[model samples]
Target: MSPLLLVVAAAGGVGAGLRYLVDRLVTPAAGARFPVGILIVNVSGSFALGVLTGLGAAVAPELSLALGAGLLGGYTTFSTVSVETVLLAERRRWRDAALNLFGTLALTAVAAGLGLLLGSAAA
Candidate 1:
């Protein structure tokens, strides 16, 4: 495999592990009504996504992927996000579940796009 691919692969594994650890640490306090894990991951991921994009824009193009994709890729947990939403909906927590589902999709897209725009603009 290409070395870049290998780097991404390694980043993915590390990101997944860190995400799991973070969820375990934060979920209990977040409570049953609110999916603290999804919220934490989503919001923090948003902030980090913004920072990564801003940094890339103000610094270098390469910084975007290295930080955005490498760091944020692992930091952000889509699977968990999906599962949370599904479980919520299944359990009849329509409000919370919908928020997780639609909110994440809309926000993450905007964040990534903004990041890319910022990164490219910086370049």
Candidate 2:
């Protein structure tokens, strides 16, 4: 395997482990009513990816790929979010479903923008 692929694979493992730990830490208190764990993961991953993208111009390609394409890619779970939202809608929790859909989009976007700004400033 190529060096970059090895780096990405290792980082992906770390990212997946981190996601599992974060979900375990955050999910139980909220119960199964909503996907709070996934929301947090997605939003945080968005911001992290934004930072990585913003820093790309100033950083090495390998670092950016390892973190952005590998770590954040492994960490974020839009599929889970989508599935949970569908489940919520099926259960007639329209408000919760809408909140999950819009809230994740809005928040992750804002977080990514902020991360970009911060990363740009740092660079």
TM-score of each: 0.71, 0.93
Clashing pairs in 2: none
Q: Which portions of model 1 show Cα errors greater than 4 Å? A: 57-63, 103-123
In candidate 2 the C-alpha lDDT for residue 45 amounts to: 93
User: What global local distance difference test value does model 2 have?
Assistant: 0.90
Top-TM-score structure, candidate number: 2
For candidate 2, lDDT tens digit of each residue in 6-118? 99998888888888888888999889788899899999999988887877579888888998888888898888889989999999999999999999999999999999988
Q: What C-alpha lDDT values do all the predictions have?
A: 0.72, 0.90
User: Tens-digit lDDT track for model 1 on 1-123?
Assistant: 777666766776776777777777887877667667666666667666775655644656555565567766887877778888889889999998988888888877776677556656565
